[model samples]
Target: MSHRMERVNQLIREELSRIMQREIRDPRLEFLSINAVETAADLGFAKVFVSHLVTSENKKEILQTLTGAAGYFRGELGKVLTLRHVPELAFYWDDSIERGARLNRLIEEANRDSVNPSGE
Candidate 1:
């Protein structure tokens, strides 16, 4: 990615976070976090990666809510962003944080086994 694209991605992420915090009133979005934003080279669309502290049971519902609100988010972006065109937002559930925690648990278990060696 070029420097300009990086800047654009960062700007979009920040603006989206702000919008979510101040504008969105959905209870499902209370603990949501915008993990990252990846915009296409032509600025036509963006893939927004997001996560929440809520249970996995609510993951599908949360994603659905975010996807349904994409248009509103884009409209809000248009009002704040100076870009020639506001990219279409696509919401995706990001599991990187969960994956990292799982990986850490595995590593710790491996270390414990290494020390014990014989299941004592």
Candidate 2:
């Protein structure tokens, strides 16, 4: 992506985060945060990745809520952004945190094994 697209992606992420924190009243989308945004090269679409602070049980419920509010979200984006065209927004769960946690556990295990040269 060009510098302009990168900046726009960041702006979209920030604005979406702010909107979730402030304006979105859907109970299902509660405890959600914008994790990342990827805008298409043509700037016609944006993939908005969100993380749910809620437990795994509620994650699906929250995603359903977000999907239901997609239209409203796009409208909100249009209102909040000054762009001539607001890209179509697609919400998705970001599992990067879970992957990071798994990687951390593996690293810790490796470090422990390294410290104990002989398995006792």
Candidate 3:
């Protein structure tokens, strides 16, 4: 990605985070975090990667809520952003953090097994 695109992504992420924290009142989004944003080259669409402390079961519900509120978010973004067109918002659950934790646990388990080959 070009430097301009990177800046755009960072700007969108920061603005979205601020909007979610101060404007949105949904209980399911209380602990939400905007991990990253990837905007299309033409600025017509954006993929918003988000994460939350809620249970995995609530992921679907959270996404639904966000999808439902996309328009509102876009409108808010328009108010704050100077872009010619505010890209459509698409929310996605970011599980990289969870995956990292699981990988760490597996690595530790492997190390433990290697240290005790005979299964003490």
- Model 3: lDDT equals 0.93
RMSD of each: 0.9, 1.7, 1.0
Residue clash pairs of candidate 1: none
Candidate 1 local lDDT, 71-98, one digit each (tens): 9999999999999999999989899999
Question: Using Cα atoms with residue i matched to residue i, what is each candidate's TM-score against the true structure?
Answer: 0.96, 0.88, 0.95
Report clashes for each candidate as comma-separated counts: 0, 0, 0
Over the stretch 1-120, how does candidate 3's per-residue lDDT look in tens digits? 999999999999999999999988889999898999999999999999999976666999999999999999999999989999999999999999899989999999999999998889
Greater-TM-score candidate between 1 and 3: 1
The better candidate by TM-score, 2 or 3, is: 3
Candidate 2 has which clashing residue pairs, if any? none
Off by over 4 Å in 3: none
In angstroms, the error of model 1 at 97 is 0.7
Lowest lDDT block of 10, candidate 3? 50-59
Better of 1 and 2 by lDDT: 1
Better of 1 and 2 by TM-score: 1
Candidate 1 is scored at a TM of: 0.96
Query: What is the C-alpha local distance difference test score of candidate 1?
Result: 0.93
